[model samples]
Target: MTSAAPHLSILDKPFVLDLFAGPGGLDVAGHALDIPSLGIEWDKSACLTRYEAGLETLHADVSAVRRDAFESLPPEINVLAGGPPCQTYSVAGKGAGRKALAEVKRYIERLMAGDSDEEIDKDLKNLSDPRTALVLEPLRYAIRATRSPNRDYRPYDIIVLEQVREVEELWKHYAKVLEETGLPDGTKYKVIVDVLDTETYGVPQTRSRAVLIARREGLGEPSLPAPTHRAYEAKEWNRRRDLALAQVHQSTLDEETAPEPEARQERGDDLQPWTSMGEVLVTPVGTHPGRDTPFLVRSNYGSSSDPGRRGVRSDQQPAFTVTGKISRFVVFQHLDESIVYEGARFSMNEAGMLQTFPPDYPWSGTAQAQQVGNAVPPLFGAHLLSAALGLPTLAPEALRKPWQPATEEQRAKLRSHGCGAADDCTARCPRPE
Candidate 1:
């Protein structure tokens, strides 16, 4: 959890490939720090984000790239960063997750093959032979397949794999692949990390996520940045608890096991102390989750419904993870708070400010809800990245102003950018059919 790298530094201003970069959260952080990064995402909204920021936006499937193609990227991508899709691994998906697990296996297999565009190309390596899958896990064989490139590329100095849950078996397979690739067994261990509170870094939101730093043999271990904010003195505090709940997953869950549906009307009226939806939402009351707007996650803590929609009380604490899968829908509730905003309500940008995004940052999208929901809070990204790389965070002059510093009026103006200036707490969100 609190991973102490053998010792690492991004003083070199590493190049990074943000695989599955949701709206450039990780990519922007690296860029702001003067690190060159390319974001690979399949979503159009996310790609637009990359384009607007003047960063390279590669529209491709990460698992589809050839290993040689990776070489085409920066020589020492100092960090290979990405958080693979975790929807399949979520407990909420229940027994229906078999396909997702299978996908993870296939994705890793393709990655082992050198992750190239020639996924089904001529002369594909049969590395993931049926014989190899068994040794790796249910799908270990996938790692041996060597990917060919469309343009030709190679590997980076280290690969940082991010994910909501640990997926121990996946790491096991990774270690096995490293051995096969000529790296020793011990060097194959993945360095998992926990995210610090973004608020400490000046982002109004309290987002936390897991980071994995992996290195090849002889590289010593990859380094992680030290926390710049003084939120907690115990550097190790976040590390251990951040390991996440995958270790204790139900392994079996269903609608029967789901938290009993709360009474919407009752919750809407007398939401308990520390249970108000506005607090976690961090906006003026009455302008969220409806009218084509997405929910805002003030913290990772909240029902697995509309993450940004419902808010927690002033003191209940954050929920474990965020992402569309496990998060609750906004038709349910919003975090508790009553800060006023534009149109007499706050906007996603305002909410994102709460979640942390650079003020000058531009998000191009008609779907504000989906865009904000999927983003990796820039502040969230900056916190972990700067700490892991043992670097300092950017000064305000070099980036957009902090979100909370904005007056209630400034926040409302930002909210209006993506959505029409409209606030309707009563509108059903996530479009319950």
Candidate 2:
């Protein structure tokens, strides 16, 4: 059936099964597009958040799930999308990819050698690796689903996987293996892999991920969606400075003149500029209670000058990548005209907005910040899945509308009902002046 929304069609939309799903970003996107989807997530906190968000979730390790569970589904899932826990392969993880990939390679070898799970578990027991061979679980599911021993063997028609940029080479290995071994139907997969920046899809955060898209032979290969926003660049810094100067001048000229929305000047003709930090902050411009000023906290006492170190982005620029350690990134807030950096970290709500989750989204459980940081922005995930489904692309304008924050009553409900514990909730929930 066709969707009521202008950008989606559900007539041929595939049922999606997302493995290692964190906080239901892909699942949320699927729901938004009217595609049926289910998520498999093992983290208790994350699963609770999924439950709170009203997304279907199965709490279990990807390695432990059986294939029959998927194969017997009534609608028969045709799309498999997931982001394996990528810490082992992220650059931030200190060269863990090399060691982790070696383990994955060995796991693949064991599978090829007909080693039983008990045999493999015996050898891998002590590894307790955050996700040593876990990334291979999706591939295992794909292969077994296609090569089932039953009379009705229907392979997953499409697979979309993502990880840190460092994992690209490992995904290349997967592609190579798939190329050599055709499916049970004896048809090879057409694989397309790339490193995509989340900002390109209008996500306010400047995060990059390694993406893998594969279609079983006969289905047309789908291209990655074109970027709807310009990536953050060195040149944009100057534009931000000029705009800040104009706003300062305007404020100086007449304090009563409301500051022009900092966001309006950042837009362009065809491609909208990247979503900015100012656009998504909880307090609107000139309305912040304390000092109404914000600044970046780039580093601490002995940070060793890592450029990737968490820092402040101008209101005109997109936010820095939101990492699992997002709670530590300080946001300076001025109180009584005195800047205090003690506890102004971005709230869970603000962080969620930076990742493009809707304002009213319910986030529950203990690890709220990590779940938000780990999630693929659902809006962007929708774009990727939509492209995979061969649906018409939505214009940048449609996706780039202004973000709205949850109201005070809504925020109160979230806080009183015990949503995830936010690090700087005290700073975030000061009595509205």
Candidate 3:
């Protein structure tokens, strides 16, 4: 399933270069937007999944790839996006928080002290701590790309970085360096680094991530995209009313086939409420039909449910954040008004779908569930690129509709903004054939 070599000529226009590309989620979204892209990754299985999906890829460790090697890329590569592995900064991880932070600080101090790349890399390698330093690789590539004289010191016009919420402080530090760096034209990038809730952007799951967006001044101010869905407020719910079993799904779910449901019912302010776990899991095949309706049963890896943890998922509410260990998520069928459970974990496909990957997407890899859980939802990726490119984003239906390649008109509009170009070429350089 390795993709054919990409048309090198396509690089004549603006394109995306994704570092640490896991399973090509960002590249998929970029392709759907008609923007050609390439991903640099090191994981064998994740790379296999990317190739199976027909995504162009480079199976190389991103840290080892020299930025100078990218000189051949068109100068119109205004967008540089990446999501470095976040295990070290994840709240759930075992990395010593203070020690990791100190290590990062020491690394930064070394860089500021003009330590050689060889020396810094040697130290990092000797530490045997991959998570602590990988988070900073994106910034390394950015600095290399912008500071390389061989490329005339060209800079990415737009940069987007994402990681776990715990890394917001580190991102803020990176923002300072980015803000101080200037393009050849002496224009500085406007940078904003903040923590954003994925559900507010219409992701079905309630995941919060640290996001950094920067614009090479004049494109517009650096800003996070406004939320497209209603925010989840647990306190706003009246448990007696919101959690009542009688207040189940308005749309009838099929028992046998469990086909995809219709459009979402609108909530307050004419916006669709957060997508519910029931909406995502109830209808896909392999879901067990409970007595009359399906309800969620949350439990750890144990066979018996814990009263403190086991809870029912209301069809009307969005799911809690989906984690890497999806098998831990057990669903129960209410039999004769009693909760009866067998091991019914969300299938790999179901997990990917919940992450907003296309339903029929051919997901490959040994760690399928982990890949799906770690990926940025393709829908959210599309929105992010849309925001970065200053293009009108898709409707919420992006979750259900198959992605269509961008059209000539769309390319024209993107070029009009001087995206990926040395100078504004709105009138010159017609759409590539």
Best by lDDT: 2
| Candidate 1 lDDT tens digits, 321-399 | 3344222322222233344222223345444444455553566655655566567766557645655565565542334
List per-candidate RMSD values in Å: 14.3, 8.8, 11.1
The superposed Cα distance between candidate 2 and the true structure at residue 397, in angstroms, equals 8.3
Query: Which candidate would rank higher by lDDT, 1 or 2?
Result: 2
Q: Between 2 and 3, whose lDDT is larger?
A: 2
Instruction: Rank the candidate models, highest TM-score first.
Output: 3, 2, 1
Clashes of 2: 1
Looking at model 1, residue 256 earns an lDDT score of 27
lDDT of each: 0.44, 0.66, 0.64
User: Which model is ahead, 1 or 3, in terms of lDDT?
Assistant: 3
Q: What local lDDT score does residue 164 receive in model 2, on the 0 to 100 scale?
A: 82
10 residues in a row with least lDDT, candidate 3: 1-10
Candidate 2 residue lDDT tens string, 149-216: 44166777888888888888878777766666654345567787788898878787778888887777
TM-score, cand. 2: 0.75
**Which ten contiguous residues of candidate 1 have the minimum total lDDT?**
423-432
Pairs in clash, predicted candidate 3: 76-420, 76-421
- TM-scores of all predicted structures: 0.54, 0.75, 0.76
> Which stretches in model 3 have alpha-carbon errors above 4 Å?
1-13, 67-76, 109-115, 125-128, 147-150, 181-187, 237-270, 283-293, 299-312, 401-433
